[model samples]
Target: MAAMWLLRTLLPLAPFARRMRHGMTLGVRAIAIGADRRVLLVRHTYSPGWHLPGGGVDVGETAVEAARRELLEETNTRAIGPLELHGVFFNPPVGGRDHVVCFRVPRFEMGPLPAPTYEIAEVGAFLIDALPETVTPATHRRLQEVASGAAPDDCW
Candidate 1:
């Protein structure tokens, strides 16, 4: 948790720190809706509110690979089938060149929840009809899009 806090504090300086790097940055988020009709969400140590389990896509990692990795790392869950690409949205508020790829993890198995880590603070399977009020707006929007079968928005 302290590590993430430090990273969050240093986040604004990241643009300058990464000025040497070229091109856009990519991230992955996994959206898992269970047979019980609940959506999996996670709270991060560095950020406020609940969000889809995810993180940055490493230098050579594919988005789906990142999604599966993050889902297990953050929530002790594993995808058991193909993950469908939901959307790729520009996340300008996070960074000028940051874009997040969302995936629907339709077939997954959740192990017992892992204890909180430096990255993840908590995890929950929230009912579709009773989402937490503190869910991040972007996450909430994504959940709505999934629930309504609506086209995804361009922004994240």
Candidate 2:
């Protein structure tokens, strides 16, 4: 009887503890680059600046799958494999438990892309050399390093 009561009490707290560990966490991004030097940007309906089309990696979803899902969800783009891990970023002094994994998608098809009905307000493709000024500082730095050949394939 005592053990049953203990298990019942602890089981309820188990999920709570797990959440606390992960934090009210989410993943997002500012930009995604594809081959042919094309950069993808999304104008958030709520936010003022333009950013890359990405969102939270759902529970039980892998990073690559999350990226692919976010890409299609936001811009209707098709990431047809050959996705490379670029880097993992941690956001601090902002929201809780936020982590973003950016990838260098090499082979993706810009399809009859649709305007995302979800959080995304607008989507556009741009040249890397002529990126917009609205990109976040972290994204800008990462892209610059990639452009200058300073960033490695796997940026942890």
Candidate 3:
């Protein structure tokens, strides 16, 4: 945990590191839906808008594994069934060619909300028709695609 903190403290150097990288990076974003159809969203300490719970995929981790790990870490939730691949996006907003594998968990079990951490500030399950105004545009786009059965596109 201390090591993670140290890395996070040094995260401002990430842009420079990305510029020196030679290849695309992979990430995972999970849209965890409850039995009531509400979706989970999180507010990160470093980012401005609420986003789906997820993070960069670790070196040896599958996208699904990364999604599950991120869900637990951010929301204390566990996927009880298979995670569906919602889409893959070429996310250029992060200053690199970040390929994000998006997943949807239709069923999950929730524990008590996690205590505030250095990374996450808040988390909650929100209804599709009543999302908070602060949700990121990309998150809203993903939800619309899921709801309307629209073909998934490469952009995010």
Per-residue C-alpha lDDT of model 1 across residues 1-156, encoded as one tens digit per residue: 999999999998888777747468899999999999998999999999999999999878899999999999999999998999999999998658899999999999999998998888899999977999999999999999999999999999
Give the Å shift of residue 4 in candidate 3.
Answer: 41
Q: Any residue pairs clashing in model 3, and if so which?
A: none
RMSD of 1: 10.0
In Å, residue 137's CA in model 3 sits off its true spot by 0.6
Query: Candidates' TM-scores?
Result: 0.86, 0.78, 0.84
Q: What lDDT tens digits, residue by residue, belong to model 2 across residues 85-111?
A: 667766664464566777777677777
lDDT of 3 by residue, 65-135 (tens): 99999999999999888999999998997765788899989889899988789999999889987899999
Q: Which structure among the candidates has the greatest TM-score?
A: 1
Candidate 1 overall Cα lDDT vs. reference?
A: 0.93
Model with the higher TM-score, candidate 1 or 2: 1
> What is the full ranking by lDDT, best candidate first?
1, 3, 2
| lDDT, residue 59, model 1 | 77
lDDT of the candidates, in the order given: 0.93, 0.72, 0.90
